[model samples]
Target: MTYKGNQTTWDKLSPSLQQKIDTDLSGIRQTVTNNKTEVTEHLAKIATTENLGHIKPDGKTIKVDPATGIASAVASTSYYVEARQTAGTTTYDVNIPDVTAYKPGLTILLKLLENNKQGAASLNINGMGVKSFIFQTYAAAVQNAGELQGGRVYQLVYDGLYFTVIGVQWVSSYEGGTDLANNPYILPSYGAVGKVDAKVAALQTQVDSKSTKDVYTINIPLISGWQGLAQITREDNNMLTLYLDIYGGTRTGGTKIGTIPAGYRPVQTYSMYFGVVTTASGSVSPQGAVISIYGSGDIYITSSNIQHNIFIASSFK
Candidate 1:
């Protein structure tokens, strides 16, 4: 039996063979129909004058400019790229599909990973022509040790001629000891540097207290960063023993030096002299006398005798 165009010798074929041919042709017809639809869709897409992304041979989507006929691989809107380290220095290589196709005002996001070293990292944008980018740590120029640490994310914008970093997320963990006090590039938000300033400010306080008959007491406010330095001076009074207590203690001897109290033995004591003065008894009194003490926690001052004016100067760190 001879086969003709679009017609097989069906009458001469066996029933089983004819059934097989029918099933095969049915599958071919369905395949052709599906292919036709796909071709039509592709042709329609090509004919449209709009900027549509097309799949490239490499399975990447390439954006096509309808008016300019320029094509470029579409960059990710928000992407994360890690930095590589060589010889203790971190670096990155940003490869753009087409530099010319990257329009101004376009932004890209990158998350950079760094090593525990004290050196500057670099980002090289290949094929960027004369364009350049400056990366910063905490809004300051990234130079010297500890500026570029692990876990940093930055947002870069292309401004037609160059790329500029517009945003940053700096991790608090610093390598190379680049703290707020040491590294000028590290801002208060980066590490514990902000607390250092508060600690320094809380180091000193001045207060005035008076003792009337036997003992005098003054309340020293509690400070978080208090270190403990107390300078106490007697403004007026006769020659008598002065007892100091940070917590609270009883005085025993008339000329006994102050004690740190039963529960406050950790407080350190220091003796300071003010000057000599004449007592009401017509005798040359002890020179201007002052006592300096250092410790932590609350301060409580006690002295002997009434009408004794006392000035207390304290510090912390």
Candidate 2:
């Protein structure tokens, strides 16, 4: 049967075309009316589109265009932070000098001071003072102690403390290292740093042991219960790996502070379910016929060159 737009008995259009037209128009209208509803429906598989998917796009948000009156472009980058180091040589003292000794652009150099020296070796700069900082080595003369050859240099400039270690390297470096060897530990730097409260706090259930790398599970009420999730085994040194299994599915992303000497945030990945229900006359592609579904986006969240943190959170229902 056919139904025309005469608002009565214009039986000229096929039912399938009518349905598809109805769906596409309805989507455009709904986007005009309410965004939250549209976003939820799109995410929940209630609504469908050709190339649309559930993706928190990089820098571009699923926002409405004020002038065009449709959901169009949105800001991309959100927050930033630098990943910290896990271990460093405790050869120098890390303490904050008096404010009088502080000067902008003046490089502050100091050591993280590792009391328990072992492994690749690194000092912890957690509770050190800010300002009064200097650099030295246990055995060799190291210039740019803030950055060294044996390891990395974690310098808390404002606090005047620093650590000489290389626990965290760039992800690209990790890939290169993997080409030579199959070790994920030689993977790269991870996580983020900076003053607290920079990004949105996604407080998860207080973990009992923060060092466990087994197949753990996280129960999120949003997803209805505890789902089997994989433990973050191959995380960057910054501790910025969030691995989760929700609704019998798995999603990997996270932002955490650790002992690495750099910072980074997880980039957003996209996945969408789309299809056409029926075909139109003279058209091969039908309505509700799924065309393509996948996820893709850039890796880095920003182009600051200066390192930053990787903050991430996810919910599935």
Candidate 3:
């Protein structure tokens, strides 16, 4: 029944409209015979507006508008996308389907494919323009090259401005030596979390099964006449160490020293040649010495001249 004026009597109103008042407004969904409680019962479920969320949207958060005092369900993007390798290193582009709107507090997880070169780095998430990373955990930290590494995940949060990098995972460049001391954003590994003293330290564990990591130091075996020791350790990310100080044997050039064993060899390749130069007074010259480590666990010391008590530890390409 259509109302012609603002004033209407109980008997004049149609039964259908009164029932609509019960179902849509009062939430009774039945014809009301009694008109005594009409005013009081009509106010039931007054807040049930079409703007309010009824259906549960998965990965969405219900928030209240401070200005209008109305609640709404918005896309939160509370999950992460699979690791994406950015085509560009300095400017990364990752496509996450769930990221539709660029609002404040919207966070995104990025898995990088290559090391971010030094200078500055930015992210273009879902083609949402380039946003430079204003990385900050404690103080204002400038973006450094190689800080955001490949095969690792990082979180970026929008603050109505630049996305701030508030977290950092372990710098897991096993054979590639990237230490954690420079990375002040170190946190616990694996899925479990402990009490973190700093906010940055609490965010490192995520998106990888590689939770266990360490440096291995194995002593290389020597022949009967060889007396000194040779130790190979994991030093830097993508780099291995081979330090040896052996003497007392009549060393032959281009000859086998001994096997370094299977587990002790570098994991990068089966066989690798390291043109190492060692300084040995009088016997072996640093210029002519060549070290060859085979994947078959054989280490050969090839030097035209012999040496004793040689200590060699320097940079290698």
Candidate 4:
């Protein structure tokens, strides 16, 4: 390139100085030409990996630091190889058109033609022998059936010995207390999974058999000249109460007014703390008798006494 400044001062110089300037200009031009030749030669040898274009005199892709040009090292992402399972179940027979031999980190897009039916599975790619497959990094964990579901696309990397899957949508062998053997796909993220039971929508499963607003049907024995009403109500608190007034004549101890259903019965004779009684004359005194409900669901006076109205509510297991 020519010098970027004007040569106006050259004409005003003494003849001898002008001669010197010309001589120096000639030498600079020669130097620049020689430098260009050396640079051109140096660049030609920098690199010429065609796939990454050669280091011509202009900007170009350079692959001098990896694979072919350099010593063993991680290569660029492998060529896209489409693999599809052709047959076999536990050990799938795969066809990866571009794969002839296994290479470390050789990743491929695999399409499963059949779902695996065993906890362990392997893939034999193009007769290259079987390579263990996994949906996760745990090589020791049971692969479990349906782990590699069919009709699904998965990315996998060949780690020399095994093909580690990039993963498909699965719950995994561990984690999630949910029972999904019947259905593995997740429900749409909307309402509670699988329409919730209306009775339990606002509560958890009452495994202890506790209930809300549980009314017990008691068998009342009809007594002459006795206007008695018995109503037992349980609020799931393991306690029963009388919500209606009970009027009865003097009955001896062990007289069964009624029996509660099996679920409402106690394990043993349970004395109720709220079975307070009053005489039909509406007199509240020591003349009243206490009631005890037995495991047989028998409800009766704990001891002999005149028929007293049980002004009731009870706390018992």
Give all candidates' CA lDDT scores.
0.46, 0.32, 0.57, 0.60
| Per-candidate TM-score against the hidden true structure | 0.28, 0.14, 0.34, 0.37
What global local distance difference test value does model 4 have? Answer: 0.60
lDDT winner between candidates 1 and 4: 4
Model 3 global lDDT (CA atoms, 0 to 1):
0.57
Indicate which candidate wins on lDDT: 4
Assess the local accuracy of residue 35 in candidate 1 as a C-alpha lDDT between 0 and 100.
100
Please give, for residues 2-90, the per-residue lDDT of candidate 1 as tens digits: 23544455577788877887788888899999999988766654534465667666545566565444432253354445554445444
Off by over 4 Å in 1: 1-66, 69-80, 88-90, 94-109, 116-121, 127-155, 160-162, 165-317
> Per-residue CA lDDT of candidate 4, range 177-291, in tens?
5556756784432233423444465455553465445555554443433356765555455665543356755467666666666666666777644434565677655645667
TM-score for candidate 3: 0.34
lDDT, residue 197, candidate 2: 31
- Per model, state how many residue pairs clash: 9, 45, 9, 4
lDDT of 2 by residue, 208-240 (tens): 445554332322222222234422222423233
Q: List, residue by residue over 93-203, the lDDT tens digit for candidate 3.
A: 767777776777777776666555666667677787977777565324335464677677777787776778766433322332445578778643422222233434544
Q: Candidate 3: which pairs clash?
A: 175-238, 175-239, 176-236, 176-237, 176-238, 177-236, 177-237, 178-237, 270-295
How many times do residue backbones clash in model 3? 9
Candidate 3 lDDT trough over 10 residues, lowest sum: 190-199
- How accurate locally is residue 195 in candidate 4, as Cα lDDT from 0 to 100? 38
